[model samples]
Target: MNEDTARLSLKIERLEALLAVTKAMVTQHDLDKLLDIIAHEAANIVGAERASIFLVTSDRRALTSKIAIGMEETGLAFSIDAGIAGYVARTGEVIVSDDPYGDERFNPRIDEETGFKTFNLATVPMYGTDEKKPGPLGVFEVLNKKDGDFSEEDLEILLALSGQAAVAIENARLLAELRLAQDKLDRENTRLRQRFLKEYAFENIIGIAPAMTELLSLASRVAESTANILITGESGTGKDLLARAIHGRSPRAEGPFVALNCAALPESLLEAELFGIEKGVATGVEERDGKIAQAAGGTLFLDEIGDMSLATQSKVLRVLQEREFTRVGGSETVRVDIRVIAATNKDLKAEIEAERFREDLFYRLDVVELCLPSLRERREDIPLLAEHFLEVYRLKSEKDIKGMSQEAHDVLVSYTWPGNVRELQNEIERAVALAKPGETIGQEILSEKVRAAAPSPLRPMADAVRALETGLIARALKESEGNKAAAAKLLGLSREGLRKKMARYEIKL
Candidate 1:
C-alpha cells in the first residue's frame, strides 16, 4: 500500500476503536465498573501498558485513584496540588511526558511504592456535565505507550476518551443521587401515613369521664381552626398523642407533622435543630432544613417547651411573631406557614414568674389551651382505658387472653397511678406476657405496688377509715337514689364534702 493510504487506514482504525469504547462506556451504569472500563480502554486505545483514573474528592483538597490498571491495590490518594495529575486537575491542561522521572511535577513515591517503571505517559482532565461543578471532575492518565513516545494523535484520542468518561461518570452520579432522594421521599410518606391512620384519629381517644368528654369536645371544636394550641399535663398523660390527633383532624392533615423535644438537646444544638444550620457552619457540618421548615403548611409540635433556654425562647418567639427565621450561621430569612403546638408538664405561669419563660411566647402558643386531666381525676375512665390497652396488647403478643378478672380490675382501679395512662398500658402489656393462653388476667399477676394498694381486711387505720367511709358513702347514695344532697344529709356531711369522698374512693351508685 502507498504511504499516504497506510496513514489514512490507521486513522480510520483509531476512530473505530474510540467509537466502540464510547458506546461501551455510555451503557455502563455502575460507577466503579464504568471507571475500570474507562481506564482499561484508555490504555488499549493508546497502546499503553497501564492506565489510572483519579477523581477529585468532594472537599476539593485531594485526588484519589478510583481505578488503577496493572495495580494490585487502588484508592491511592495525594494532595490536589502535588503530582502531575494534580497539575492537570488544577490547570485543566493535558500533559505528555516522555521521561516522568525528569519532571518536577511528577512524584516518584508512587513509582517506589508500586515498583512500576514509566517511560512515556499522557494525562488529560475530565470535566463534569453539571454547571454547578465548574472545575474538572478528575484526571485520566495512561502510562508507558507500547509502540513509541505518546504523539499528538495519542493525546487527541485520550482527550476524546476522557470527555466521554466524564459525561458517563456524571450521569451515574446523578442517577445515584436521584435514587437516594426518591427513597427518602418514600420513607417520609410511609411515616406520615402510619401516623394518621384511623386508629390514631381524634374520635379514637379512649375516654368516657366528664372531664375527658369536655376536653375532647373542645379539642374537636378547635381542630379545624388555625389558632396555635398549648397542651398542659403531667408526664405520661398522652400529650404527644393528643397533639398528633389534633394534627390528624386539622385542615393541614395532608402536610407533614414534625416534632421536636425542647429538653432533649443542649442550648447550642437545640438552636441548630430548630432553625437548621448553614453549610460549613462548623467542621463537616452540611446544610439542612429545620423542624419548622419541615412542618411548613402543617404543624410543629414542641414538647417540653418550658425547658427551652431563655435565648432559644427569644428566637422561637420571633418565628411565632413574624413567621420567618434565619438559620444558624446564616443570614437569609426563610418564611414558613405552619401551626404551632407546644406542650409541657411544667407550669409555664410559674416559669414566667421565675423569669425563666417568656410571657409573650406563652401567649402566642396558648391561643387555645387544653389541659389534660390526670388519670386520678378521671377515675371513671380507668376501666375503659384498661380494656382498650388489654385488647391492644393481646393482639400484639398474639395471646388468647380474654379479659381481666373482677378482682384484678378492682385492684387496678384502686391504685393511685402516679405515672398515669402510660403506667396502665405498661402494666397491661406485662400481664399479657405473663398470663397463660385462654385465661383471664387475675389479681395474682398484678404488679406488687398495685396489689398492695387493694383494700384488705387487715389494713392500717388510715386504710380502714377510707374503706369504711367509702362503704358508708355508697350505702347513702343507694338509699338516696343517687341524689348527692340527700346522701350528704343522710350521712350528716355537706354535699361538696360527700362528693369529694365519693371521688376519692371511686364510689359509684
Candidate 2:
C-alpha cells in the first residue's frame, strides 16, 4: 500500500480501537471492575506494558488505587504530593517521560514496595465535566511502551481514553449513591407503615368512657357480618376511623378497603365515580371499573352519605336492595359483593321530612345504625387522645418531645371541639411542629382562638339578655358535645334558628 493509504488505514484502526474501549467501559457498572477495565484498556490502546488508575480520596489529600493491572497487589494508596502520578493529579497536567528516574517528582517508594522496576511512562490527568475550569478527577498512567519510549501519539491516545474513564467513573459513583438513597427511603416507608398499623389498631382506640365502650362493643359485634351499616355522628367524629376498624376486623381483612366521601364529588359525576363508566359516556372518558368494583371482596365506605343528591341516593338504594348497580349511560347490571359502611353527620330523618332525602333509602341503609358520640360528650377521653396524637406528630417531626404539659392538657379539655377528633388531631400536629426539641408541648403553642376559649364567669353580665342567650347556647353545646341538633332541641329552637344564633355569637364548630 502507498504511504497515504497506509496512514488512512492506521487512523481507521485507531478509531475502531477507541470505539471498542468506550463500549467496554460503558458496559461495566461495578466501580472496581470498571476501574480495572479502564486501566487495562488504556495500557492496551497505547501499546504499554502496564497501567494504573488512581482516584482522589474524599479528603482530597491522597490518591487511592483500587485497580492496578500488571501489579502484585491491586490496592495501593499514596499522597498526592509524592509521586509522578500524584504530580499529574495535583497540577492537572500530562507528563511524558522516557526516563522516570531522571524526574524529581518520581517517588521510588511504590516501586520498592511492589518489587517492580519503573521505566518510561506517560501520565494523564482525568478531568471532570466542567470545561470552563476543569477539576481533577484522577490520574491515568501507563509504563514502558512496547516498541520504544512513550511517544506524543501514545500520550494523546491515553488522554482520550482517560476522558471516557472519567465520565464512566462519575456515572458509577452517582448510580451507587442513588441506590443507597433509594434503600434508605424504602426502609423509612416500611417503618412508617408499621407504625401506622400499630398506632391505629382496634385495641388502641383510646376512649375508656362508658359511651365509647358501648359504641366499640356494638361495632366489634357487627364487624363479623356482611350487613350494611349506617354510622351517624356530628362532623369530625371518628366515623371514618370506625369504618376502617370494622374492615380491618372483618373476614376480608387482607382485601382492600376503599373509601369515598359522598359530599366531596359533584352530583353530575357521583354516579359514574361510584358505579364505573363505559367509553363514549362523555368527552375524554375511558372504560373503567369504579369504586364498587374495586372494593369487591372488601369494604366500601361511603362517607357523608347525607350530602349525596337525590338521584345518586336512589342509585345507592338499588345497590343495597338488589346487590347490584348500573353504570352511567350503560345497561349492564354490575354486581358487587362488597360490605357497605355508610356514614353521615346530617340527620337523615330530618332530611326525609323536608323531601330532600328518600325515606325508603333510609330504611335500607339503617339496617345496623352505629352512633358515635361527639368529642365534648366524651371529654374524659381528651387526655388519652392528646397523648396519642402527640406521640404520632413527635415521630413525624423527628422531635424528642415527651408529652403535653398540665396547662396544655387543661386547654385541650376545656375547649369545645366543634370539629371533634379531627380538629384535635390537627391542633396536636401544629403543636408538635412548633415545639422545641426535648420539650413537652405547652398551651403557648395553641391557636389563639383555642387559647381564648373560656367558660362564662359568674360575675360577668355586660348585657343580661345577650349574656343569658350566649351562655345558655354555649352550655347546651358543651353538654351535648357540640351536637347542634341536640343543643337546639334542648333550647326549644329549630336547628336553623340555633345555627343563626351560634353564628351571631361567633360560636365555631
Candidate 3:
C-alpha cells in the first residue's frame, strides 16, 4: 500500500478505537472497572506495552494510580511535583519523554519497586469541563511504545480520552460516596433497633433519672461478682424486679432464676420450703428440691428476707457459710453452687436492736448492699415509668392509647409515691385500661388514691393552719350571733384569751 493510503487507514482505526473506548468508559460506572478498561485501551490504541491512570488526591499533594497495566499490583502513589505524571498533574501540561531515565522529572523508585523499565512515555493531564482555572483531574500515561516512540497523533488521542476519563471518574467517585453513606445509615438503623429492644425489655428496667442511671450502672458492675447481695428499699419499690435484672445481666442468665418470698410462708413451712423435703418427711409428701437446689448454677432471690424468723435465718446462714445443707429428714448432705440475692423493706439494724433478727445472718447477706431509691426520691423518673407502663398495658389490652396528657403527668409527678414504682405502674395500667381508644391518659382516668396525693398549694404549713383557725373562728362568731363571749365559750377559750385569739386569728367578732 502507498504511504498516503496507509496513513489514512491508521487515522480511521484510531478514531474508531477512540469512539469505542469513550462508549465503554461512559457505560461502566464502577470506578475500578472503568480505570482498568481505560488503562488497557490507552496502551493498545497508542501501541504501547504499559499504561496507567493516576488521579489527583483531594489534597492535591499526590497522584494515585488505581489501575496500572503490566504492573504487579495497582494503588501506586507519588508526590504531585516529583515525577513526570506528577508534573503533568500539577502543571496541567502534556509531557512526552524519550529519555525518561535522563529526565529530571522522572522518579526512579516506582520503576525499581515494580521492576518495569520505561524507554519512552507520554503523559497528558485529564481536565474537567470547567476552564476558568487549571481544572486538571489526573495524569494519563502510556509507556514504551512497541513500534517507535509515541508520536504527536498518539498524544492528541490521549488528551481527548483524558477529558472523557475525567467525567467518568468523577461520576463513579460520587456514586461510591453515596453507597458508603447509605451503608452507614443502614448500620445505624440496625444499631438503634437493637438498642431499643435491649433497653425496653421487661427485665431490663428502664429509668432516665441520674440516680436510677447510676443505680443500674452499679447493678451491672455487681452482677459480675458471685457475692451475696442485700437489696433494701421500701415495699413496692421493685426490689424483686431489680434482683431479676441483676440475674439477667449476670453471666448465669441462661441458668434458672429461683425466687421465693420469705414472708409468704409460715416459719415451719418456710424452713421446709428452703431446705427441701425428703419423702415421708411429711404426710404423703414426695421428695422435692428447695429453691436453693433449684437455683444451682444460677441465682436465688429471697424476697422480704427481713420477715424470716430467727431460726430460719440461722439455717440460711449455715448454707451461706458452709455451702452445704441437708433436707428436713434426709441424711445426705447437699452442696450448692449458687448466688443469693436477698431483698427486704425492713431495716435489719433496727430489727437487731429489737432482738428480732439475727445479726450474724444480716452480716452474711449484706456482702454487697444495693439500696434502691423510693419513687419520691427519684421523682424525675415518674414520667418515664408512667410512659413505659402505658405502652406495656396498651399492648397488653390492645388499646390505641398513644401517650399521657400533661395534666396526668403533673398528677403523677406531684403525687408522693409511698408504694414507689409498683404503685406508679399500677396507676398507669389502670389509666390505660380506662382510657378511650386513641385517647391519651388524663388525670380523670387515674385512680383516686394517686389523685388525692397531689400536692396542695405551695404555702407554709403554719400560715395555712392559721388561716384555717381564722375561718373556723369567724364561722363560730356568725353562729354565736357575733357575741365574742359566746364564741369564746364555744371555742373553749377564756374570755380574756378570746380577745387575743380573735386578734391573732383576724376574726371580726
Which residue ranges in model 3 land beyond 4 Å of their true spot?
1-203, 455-509
The total of clashing pairs for model 3 equals 0
For candidate 1, the per-residue lDDT at 189 reads: 83
lDDT of 1 by residue, 1-509 (tens): 69989778768877887777777776767888877876777787778998998899888889999889888769699999888999999999999999898999998888888888888789999998788875899999999999989988888878887887788878888899999999999898878676675656877898888998899899988988999999999998999989988988898888878999999999999999999999999999999989999999999999999999999999999999999999999999999999999999999999999999999999999999999999988888888888899999999989999799988888999998999999999999899999999999999998999999988757699988997898888888889999999999999999999978888888766
Give the RMSD in angstroms, all C-alphas superposed, for model 2: 12.5
RMSD of each: 14.1, 12.5, 20.9
Show where candidate 2 strays beyond 4 Å: 2-13, 130-134, 208-232, 243-344, 347-371, 375-509
Task: For candidate 3, list the clashing residue pairs, or say none.
Answer: none
Highest lDDT: give the candidate number: 1
Residue 378 Cα positional deviation in candidate 2, in Å, after optimal superposition: 6.6
For model 3, give the RMSD to the true fold: 20.9
How far in Å is the alpha carbon of 148 misplaced in model 3?
98
List ranges where model 1 is wrong by over 4 Å: 1-195, 457-509
Write down the TM-score of every candidate.
0.57, 0.58, 0.54
